[model samples]
Target: MRFPWVDYVVSGEADLLIGPLCWDILNRGRDIPPADLPFGVFGPAHREAGYPAASTRDLVPRAVIENMGDLPLPDFSDYFAELNASLYADRIHAGLPMEFSRGCWWGERSHCTFCGLNGGSMTYRQKPARQAAEEMIEMSARYGSSRIEAVDNILATDYLKKALPRLTALPEKLAIFFEVKANLKRHEVEKLAAAGVRWIQPGIESLDTRVLKLMRKGTSSAHNVQLLKWCRQNGVRVSWSLLWGFPGESDAWYAEMAPLLPLLHHLQPGPAVRLRYQRYSPYHYTAEKHGLKLRPAVSYRYVYPLSERDLADQVYYFEDSEDDDVGGHFAAGSANRRPGLSAVAKGIDAWLKAWYEPKLSMLSMRDSGDEIIVEDTRAIAVEREHRVRGLAREILLAADEGSPETRLREQLSGTNVMQAEIEAAIADMIARKLIVRLDARLVGLALWHPYTPIPPMTAFPGGYFDRRAAPLGTSRE
Candidate 1:
């Protein structure tokens, strides 16, 4: 309902069939008669003659599954057996699906403005770390596959403390994937790789801090960048996408953020897309609060003959009526939005295309104690290697987690680096796009050299901060 439902555009005559009117149906120990179930039937069932009348208001709320461990292992033997018997000769290496957690921890605190998922029950719950790890091993052994995928909305951070470490000690390696919040630190990414988590779907919807704020993403752009950088360095495949079109977002935000995309070619890039409104999301339920008027999307008309009012309850997709503009420029593709969006789109397309190219441009650095060497072969500043050994080098590395000039100065207290020198170095790095000045703080742009065990700097040929540096901001020819 969050993504694929928004993108589904095909048309055909069909009844929208919703499965069982049960949220915790699995919790029931025995099969209940249809008469005992809530009679909130839709489509054909309600249309049948002599339909039994039942009031949904009379039914009590189903209890949420308190102990996730109470659930038995999902039966996937049938799926594998069917696959083996099918005409297809090749055996599919299936990633056994499992869930040790329910709801979203982040959502319970601050639901993303555009997220409509887990609306029915947003309370976060998870199995004990040991229980979760045991299931992973048992499922793999039972299903005869080392690949596993967690269907949980977010990876339980508790696993990093114990479960992942336990898996890391196993004799046989297992490939695992999960959706994680992108505010992960370097060691966490390393731990994930060590535990055989080869893939991750991180929630990094936008690169601009202001844009991310509109959706309450609870992560800074620098944090997201660090996650992407750390994942790439640790051999973890990241799955993410960039979204735009928030109601109060400024086109200038995109314009300002687009230039940094090329600086990130070494890292994976996800799709750049427009924001969509979905049922249960804040935008849909409380439209006027965000300066929007909701209506069923035009595509819905193709499926149902009912009026918009009748479709309101059944439909999940929606469109906003606060168009032609809002608060100056807020239309889907407003005039002010195009130039910035075009710039971002072009950059994203190039970033994605580079993965297919034989020689992709990258900005990487290796630490050599106090000295740092940077290799820049990005869309811009591809002239040479950067060598930094003094105050500039100190400032560049100190800002890795994003720090204000005052903090950089404070962190380097009693050092040879002065406040003036720190300011100059940060300005120079921002100009070179070697580091970004985001939200009044400096974040080091170069990823740590993959082969380096500790902090190191890298420079290709023309250094940005060193004395023998070429002119800064040299665009690659």
Candidate 2:
């Protein structure tokens, strides 16, 4: 009987005990009998002799490598040498996945209901900023690959002030991937671009505030849209999923959000998917509490012909008893139940089709000294020229990317643009689709160039972090 490797111990087939648990038991000299070895560990264990047992959770913490310079370089040259050179066509260099952190910082607080990505642990730990940056440079140099994917669940906010400056100083601009919160500031997005982080998986799960609150994502719909706009302006490509499915959600929420989708045609679009029940998520843990009765998904029956009890131990996906759990019977790719849910799904589909067909649209603005000339070419029929001077020009220029109403007032500190004029201008622009008022912040939708191309959309696209290497002006080949 083994101790911690309880699967082997449970089968009553192992002759020796190993792993941390066994070592802890032997080291402590505990009085656990051999017959009752696998009590706490998962699954049923059979009894046998000649094996040891332990029940200690004394694992060492992850070490912070202060100077990664001292560590041995990972050897991948031999591995890369075996690959065909033809496979490397049209690429700057091969890519590699790397990690600088573990668990998730946000999961420690309000864990998203449908997320199981963090497993049992939510203790956020990260490498020191300088060590992390240097290691990235070293690894990329050693492997001769410029693409580095940081598989952290969420980027540590401290990295912006700490690691990003050091990363910007690297001679070769390496392509870096990160998972970020959607409520990033405009300056933060700019810094991310400067630091060579060109790709991100910001969790913009839903564009409806009610759905967001139900999932406990701690971000609003406006905030997610703001991120998409900033990502476009700062040249960062966002890879995200739009998921719908939550207990106690109304159909009205989706219907209201659908009409606003066309206004964001210039931004990147992602596929709409149903909320799935995962094993380690809050939804799975408290399914019954939330009026959800779960059975192992249909695929599990084919994989395991055993009893339901046995299958429950192996399967991760589950089918809830309530068919109308999300948006009143929205299932898989089809949404036939409620009109509102169907409208929402259809809106997302249209957005993706527009993006795929390259139905490019933009409202461009230029500061020609005396006045700001605006050209509107959005999907809306009014694709014409408009000129703004004086206070309107000041406000639009100040809020070229985005600004809070309070900050707009602060920026116009010296100008005589009265509060009434600014308010009227903002309202007019929003009505004209030249600018969008998201919550308390106003963002100008116009780009510097007309027909600004939406970056190639992919569920997962690969590229280097250097801005020059981005698929900005080029088509997906």
Candidate 3:
């Protein structure tokens, strides 16, 4: 019953260490010596009998359990049974959390400068498509649920082409949630929706192109916008965040983008937050080289009440302060140096406020007879009722939940529909914001809203994961 962040400060004297941080160390100890191997301690042990802290950068060989099918299926029946009868009943069934993959493929290349989720395990591996489909089906049947929450660091590319088709063939639809990169095409998004992936957490950290580049997110502002557009088109709910405070970023970018915020009103809005430094992130390991001055967050000082050295050993997060004198970092400037940042923040707040409004969204459509009527109320508006017919109407309905141009054309086969008509419909739809085109694919610009009303939760607020009241310093044999 020890908290890793707090207990690790004193638990260094313990006889054994476990969990992911020490997983490779224990497995490879017999095969490779610690010094010559890619895994193990980078410094001296904390105490006379204790093991040194595990290295997060080690590229040691992972155990055979890399294939998720070999693992035991988790049981959530007991928890669900209690939850159903309790006051905390009103909640979204986002489904049971599971993993189909391990580590991040991108991290092995240019890792997002602020992320450390993969830690030492940068090698990517996934359960086979058939195995993954079978596991989800089994879990749904066992738990009487039709949803799965995949906890993969990032959705493996193979899953898009392989696993999706297998899942689509399942007898029942399972609402699967995923974390995806922002550079996906419209067809890929439609495939995910067709395969029962109802939601995604696309890591679109910033919309400012320069800030994105500074963070090495390997994506552009336009690319992020397209992803959001496609997600809405595919009836996929996207949960993302807007982050700022990069070491080498300039405030000018935010200023330039603020006025354009209204144009994005048709899409989902994410909260704007300051960036946080985490353990094993590029920012944490190479702060000095990036012109960043790192220190523990102020809250940690007040919460832990421990010496800085002990806090440093256990803490996995940091606060960055740029030196004014540093050349790459921002220097003291006119008071208006951050006007653009504030403007952008204000725009985001307004966008979020509009997002929750009862009658508004990026786009909402209704199929009416032979003509498709569109209400474009995004940043730029078409106040009049925009309409289209024939091939355009057919394409809109087919792509209401997103479809590739090729898929749409294939669906129109045997009909008198021609390629020129399809292409013209796509062009008109894009101009009216009735649909979004990405990577030569098109998705209808409509957000999916659930029709059923959800039950209210009880007044009491609690969850099983509330570890704040758990007693510490307990030992287990």
Query: What TM value does model 1 have?
Result: 0.80
Pick out the ten consecutive residues of candidate 2 with the lowest summed lDDT. 55-64
Q: Candidate 3 on 261-352: residue-level lDDT in tens?
A: 66678677888777778877899889889877777765688888787767765577877654332222222352265777778888888988
lDDT of 1 at 164: 94
Candidate number of the best lDDT? 1
62-147 per-residue lDDT for model 2 (tens digits): 22233323444356676667643544333334566766776678888888899877655456777777777888888887877777
Best by TM-score: 1
lDDT of model 3 at position 80: 82
Model 2 off-target regions past 4 Å? 1-78, 84-93, 324-336, 368-370, 390-426, 440-443, 448-477
lDDT of 1: 0.71
How many pairs collide in each candidate, listed in order? 21, 3, 2
Q: How does each model score on TM-score?
A: 0.80, 0.76, 0.68
Off by over 4 Å in 1: 1-35, 38-63, 89-91, 324-337, 413-416, 451-477
